[model samples]
Target: MEDLWQAFVNVDSAGNITGDYSGKNIVAEDPYDFFFLVDKEVALSLHEYKVHLDGFKPSLVPKQSAE
Candidate 1:
């Protein structure tokens, strides 16, 4: 038998972690990967995750305009 571990991450602007994953020193450059890690670590059901995610909204990067 194997024991599975999970971790929830919350990052803010400037690539700084600011939530459950804070102080872990894990830096991420891609928002998709970052959120994916968070979602995976949560280990929650789809409905539960949707409710949780909706309640805890994270900051998103602003889109850059083409010159």
Candidate 2:
């Protein structure tokens, strides 16, 4: 028997996201369902690993010359 790996995204109750890699092989009874499962797992992982965006501002400002 061979082992397979799958990627997943975990979400917490606080709406936090995290990425995870599992070593479980999902046996899809239906061929069509196989792709769906894979996609769902991947999406979850991505959501978990989402990045945070902080406030940003432009630093380019015109300087006034003192008479």
Candidate 3:
């Protein structure tokens, strides 16, 4: 099971919005429900979430080879 999914939106200087998910076009007129699930109970929108993991830097640990 995948725990995370992401979508990126792009807009040019002309204010043209563009995005795609899984190779399909993103529709701006569609109703988008961005939310967060906590402890299998609470819920929050994309803006309401407290912690943003994406901004954090990754660890420099080297991968262990199984060979």
Candidate 4:
């Protein structure tokens, strides 16, 4: 199995990214994917979002006991 992290562009009335771009990165998994979209007026801009995953949130199994 593969692990993954995810994020989405949070938009406001104007459709701009609601939060700062402090943590966002572009992924090359799929080029033609619609990662972002904005309406006219130029008031809104899509943001590339990303996340990091060191490992599963919690191990499925507990630490093995000494054999």
User: Who wins the TM-score comparison?
Assistant: 1
lDDT of residue 33 for candidate 4: 17
Give each model's whole-structure lDDT: 0.33, 0.32, 0.26, 0.27
Best by lDDT: 1
Q: Pairing residues by index, what is the TM-score of model 2?
A: 0.22
The Cα error of candidate 3 at residue 53, in Å, is 20
Q: Which ten residues in a row have the lowest lDDT in candidate 3?
A: 58-67
TM-score of 3: 0.18
Which residue pairs clash in candidate 1?
none
Query: Per-residue lDDT tens digits of candidate 4, residues 1-67?
Result: 3222223333443333444221134353433212322222111222332222236331111112111
Badly placed stretches (over 4 Å) of model 1 are 1-4, 21-67
| lDDT by residue (tens digit), candidate 2, 14-40 | 323433333356543322201212344
**Estimated TM-score for each candidate:** 0.24, 0.22, 0.18, 0.21
* Candidate 4 ranges beyond 4 A from true positions: 1-7, 20-67
- How does model 3 fare in lDDT? 0.26
lDDT of 1: 0.33
Looking at model 3, the pairs that clash are none
TM-score-wise, the better of 1 and 3 is: 1
What is model 1's C-alpha RMSD?
Answer: 11.9
